[model samples]
Target: MPNHTLVNNIDHKDTKIITERSAAYGDDIWFTQTFPAEYRSVQAYYPIFFTKDENTGRFFSVALFGFQQNENLFIKDNRWSVPYIPLTHARTPFLIGEQALMEDGIEKHQRVLFLDEDHPRVNTEQGEPLFLEFGANAPYLESMADMMEVLHHGIEDHNAFIDMLVELELLESFTLDVELNDRSQHQMLGFYTINEDKLAALSSEVIAKLHQNGHLQPIYMTLASQSNVTRLIQLKNAQLGL
Candidate 1:
């Protein structure tokens, strides 16, 4: 496969960074971006993943870039915006489990690895998220579809998450799937309506835990009606005989 180009203008002579700072093993590169203010919930520690394409093969990389602002989750990096999901994490930490488990006769609750205990649970910090991404012998078009699905799951599984929150009492009975002005946005769907009063009373740590586990964006995009990378193939097919 003459490798469909995935990443372009990679300054590292086409070599990009993985899990943050791909400039070089010796180069201290810290990737950062600034996100919109409307999205207040994103944590700085959220890792961004990427992929590279060459004539012989394709590769993927995961990065945990830093944000200049202490208050937002967005990055200043031109190539690594929060929204782009790389094919590297086709199998993300966004695991779907049947139920909780026990370890050595004691309850073994598997916290989503994204959680950062050092941060004030809710104060304003998400600990350095563990970044792990790998490559495989696959093309971007197919690989990206699977990666996007995982991202979609992370965003749209709101109701299922709300159910989990109720089971955990992270919120005193929450509702979800609320849709917004745009059908693609939340207002059109349901909402995780917390008992407003009870919700306010909860601790920040408890709240942060919920945000970390929500996987909000991943699921939303996965199930979203608008995003369609497949359209590219269709357009190309039309020009095939040209």
Candidate 2:
């Protein structure tokens, strides 16, 4: 239930948003939506995986932060411990949306900036201002627009990439069973990952096709990112005082 509205300087002239990384601002997320374009950075610090939306049955890429629900090991003392926060996580309270516009007696849809009025980060004072004295966008606001642009295109590209993986029979459901330092057992389910066996078994022709389509590098990056799972385990253990 996001209270999204097309951004306008007049309607939101005094709006200021906190840009700090803190759990109070809702940064304690277990995972954030991710895409192939961000795999290189995201994979370096977090394990990349996929989950299917129960309502839509659509697949989404994600960067993992913790092993279980509602747990984010990265948040310690209300500060994010990681350097490379995913764009999707950083771009809170703002999103790209479409609006109908009329031009020359014809109607068309145009992309517009939307902000969540109900987000905790949004406030009227003591943060980055959305506009200047004369209705000009603030510097930080401009940066947010750039980030939103990248995210908008990245989401489109990622949807196609996921489709390609599914078409090639490269996606498989995986279950992770973990034993904590205290000998506590945990099991993670309902997530998907690329099948390395299927990927390696592909013919040269198919590999060439994947390469031509700009999907080959990200595929390898996702595979290499599995190594980061051990890092996640270490973080969890540290959080547990092990």
Candidate 3:
């Protein structure tokens, strides 16, 4: 379980975070949540798919890195092999939390930064420092704050986009079957993808609405990203040396 606590410079001035990408630091995830704003970059290197949360049953988008669980093929030589990492993956050890603040004598909740003390990347020595010598945020911390801000808005957009997709009945469940060069086979299930037939069958007015609302491109981007599945198979074959 993650031990999350509010971050303050005074109490955590000496905190450092390991920025390296490696399985040792828990980068061995097969997929991570993504949003439409990131689809352009994510589609270039990953296959974007929709999945439902087991607990909430809410649908969300993800960038697939591998065919199975805990099999991240993008980690190479203790580093991310790709140029762009999904913001959800890049913003580690830090997450957005709510803080109550007084505004005109009324208490209001505001988004604040929270740190996961139990994360493997967190430490007091080595790696990127979170605070400078004089209780100010370091460059790495600043960047993380910016990332969290982007993620906050991205999640909002993601929710609205998913609602639109669900309303239009554009999502469909899918199962992916993979065969490795060593003759080993695997099946990936419980994921969803866009229903192209439904999308095409949508009325022109509906299509125009999607385009006007800035979702049509991402829908197409998700479709385009499926091609990267072939690349993933190649990587798996290379990893298996067959």
On lDDT, the candidate that comes out on top is 3
- Residues 127-217, model 2: lDDT tens digits: 8999998999989889989999999999999999989998998999999888889999888999999998999899999999999999999
Off by over 4 Å in 1: 1-44, 47-73, 81-138, 155-158, 172-242
Model 3, C-alpha of 5: deviation from truth (Å): 1.5
Q: For candidate 2, what is the TM-score? A: 0.95
Residues 36-59, model 3: lDDT tens digits: 999999999999999989999999
Question: If scored against the real structure, what TM-score would every candidate get?
Answer: 0.21, 0.95, 0.97
Q: Candidate 3: where is the Cα deviation over 4 Å?
A: none
* Candidate 1 local lDDT, 126-197, one digit each (tens): 322222133322242234344444544543443355355456443321222322223332211111222346
When sorted by TM-score, best at the front, the candidate numbers are 3, 2, 1
Per-candidate local distance difference test: 0.31, 0.89, 0.94
User: What clash count goes with each model?
Assistant: 45, 0, 0
Candidate 3: the clashing residue pairs are none
- Which pairs of residues clash in candidate 2, taking residues 3 or more apart in a chain or in different chains? none
